[model samples]
Target: MSTSLQVGKILNNNNRITSGEIMGSSREGGGRGAEEDEFLLQIPEASAKVPKDAFHLAYIFYFTLGAGFLLPWNAFITAVDYFTYLYPEVSVDRVFAVTYMLVCLLFLLFIIGWAHKSSAYLRINIGLALFVLSLLIVPLTDLLYVKGTRGLYSGYYITVAAVALSGVADALVQGGVIGSAGELPKRYMQATVAGTAASGVLVSVMRIITKAIYPQTANGLRSSANLYFSVSIVVMVICLVCYNMADRLPVIQYYRDLKMQAMNEESKEKGPLSGSAWRSTLWDIVGRVKWFGFGIFLIYVVTLSIFPGYITEDVQSLLLKDWYPILLIAGYNVFDLVGKSLTAIYLVDNANVAVAACIARLLFYPLFLGCLHGPTFFRTEIPVTVLTCLLGLTNGYLTSVLMILAPKVVPLQCAETAGIVIVLFLILGLAVGSVVAWFWVI
Candidate 1:
């Protein structure tokens, strides 16, 4: 199933894939010996060549940075009940989603369209700082402003502002980390994805702990919110530190050097890119990986269609009651994490097969719709939970695979641009899915 395993199968078939071009030489000039050489080349290059043994550390930090960027967002989403309690009259959940997506989409367009050439490190650091501030704003407002005013409007508006800030932060970190990982080897991309899934797991665990330890009273809920946000803030600080340290690591520096060399070569070949050139670059990336882009777009479209709000609101378990949604969401996060991490062991490298699999995710829509309005058995908790796990697994694995492979399909200089384009497609999918999600209410 994995590309690595497929390599051996291809070798047994007499190295027909690359026509033995990968092989150096053989006794027959194209026999088993040459085939073995070709097989060796297909093995992923290890990051061990990174100077001073910092490669693994840098590699891990990329994962952490990825997880870190999504943690705050996850924490907020997981605390949906808390937000609902604070602002009973408002549709805080949908409001936050709308505001967050809008801000992230706008800022992402600006970054890629105009500031794509800027420093990723600088942007990410600022983003991390903003993320920390966003987390702090909620509690700080509750502590300083809410108690004095006793008006729900003040806290609600403050929470909305905090959500907006988180969106802006997401745009910075998502763009920077994804773009950076895209330029590096495939493994880093996997790491980043695994990290994102891990964030969900981490936040899910935190919620479970807080819910169990605290009483079910209003005070208990408030206390849990404080503790959760406090921990998220601390995690953001660590993420900031790890990101800066990773930048100085020898392995990261090696990639930086490679990127610089590629940029220098491109600059020499073509003078500075004008406005028209920027537009052309986008079209070029689209033309090169339209299917890959479509695959990514559909992947998120199907995923966002059912995740978070849909799962939390539309589904109910007569047995589990309050714990039903929580457990189902946790299951999704855990399996999604597993699916993403598995790619490190075995990647599906065939672009066509991968793309086709992504398109097949459309089956989820009808399947989920059936659960909502089909046979009585289909509405049961077990079936729904199982479906949720499969959805998460497929979403995580396919997204990582497409993202990891798409950029490599292009030239080195265009890889970063390609990465940005993929993110754009991903965001577009999110927007479309969010819109479609509203149909659940109708």
Candidate 2:
């Protein structure tokens, strides 16, 4: 009889075989996985033992931290009416696009070059503090100018400065949070993306509630804006606290310890990555997955082209009136959240399929245009809403898949760089799409 069969027979006929015979048969059957496989033997020794509560808290912290990072940016984008109220003479859309892009690029380059060395916790704390200060700058300036004896036009300059500051904060928090999460498990990465979608939904809901609660008059709009930013500031503070607490969680610490151990081993083997070595490592990652990068770029380009720029500004409904944009944006946010969350169920594993799906998003341009200039029915509320939801869903799902897949494709040491590079492509796509959004007027 074969080793496994003999072992089974020996166990069944307990009195017939000696213990020594059973042990010999069991060792011989180890390869068959009959309670003696090497893989099974290794699992208990290798796996990290994490507390259940710590694992759960880490998820919440990661998700909330991701949302907190993007919340202020969403606040700026969603509050189109308030900003237009502040600067009627200027094209706030184009101004915001250019300024935010410029600031993100500048600050992102700094992080990749030098600030990446800093602990993510420190960077996140600074970013959160700056965000609170940026949010406070606008309302406080408006209060001083309107209630006190300050000049009238000064509010415009202050608002511009505040927006620019918010953009800077975005770069810091975004890079730190994403880079830190990338070093953890894939689910944490998913949590971060889901959090981003949730932030958009949260801000959309906040705008809807505030708009309903307050009147449409200038003073009422100002009050609404104040309440929205105030709530956002509170959320940011909570995220900062939660992030620190998460660092102390058993599950998070386990991952951090493993990462450090691997990093140390790598340094000993390769003698710390010199500047050229780092460049070479990044270049190898690029060469291996250039298509993946392109797919991510396209995903963001198409997404940025439609969202906020188009959904917030171009689409309109006579019945819903001003509520049209708000509701549409909320729909997009909701679907996007669902799409990101769905990855927990099933993610597309094939790279070709994911890339092809991304390229298909080019269809969104023509489809959205049809909504703008097609037959009257195409321009109606239902079609626009459906297309907007599809747009958000695809954007959320594809971006999450690409971000999650890119790092795993790379070597362990290159994983962090892969995530950061993917983000850089994402930002590039946003900048390009924002510029393209201007052509909608033509």
lDDT (Cα, tens digit) per residue for candidate 1, span 350-398: 9899999998998988888888989999999878988999999998899
For each candidate in turn, give its C-alpha RMSD to the true structure in angstroms: 7.3, 9.7
Tell me, by TM-score, which candidate is best: 1
Backbone clashes in each candidate structure, one number apiece? Answer: 0, 0
Query: What shift in Å separates residue 107 of candidate 1 from its native position after superposition?
Result: 0.7
- How far off is model 2, as Cα RMSD? 9.7
Q: Model 1: clashing residue pairs?
A: none
Model 2 lowest lDDT segment of ten: 20-29
Q: Tell me each candidate's TM-score.
A: 0.87, 0.86
Q: How well does model 1 score by local distance difference test?
A: 0.77
Alpha-carbon lDDT, every model = 0.77, 0.72
| Candidate 2 lDDT, 93-131, residue by residue in tens | 767776777687678777666532556678778888899
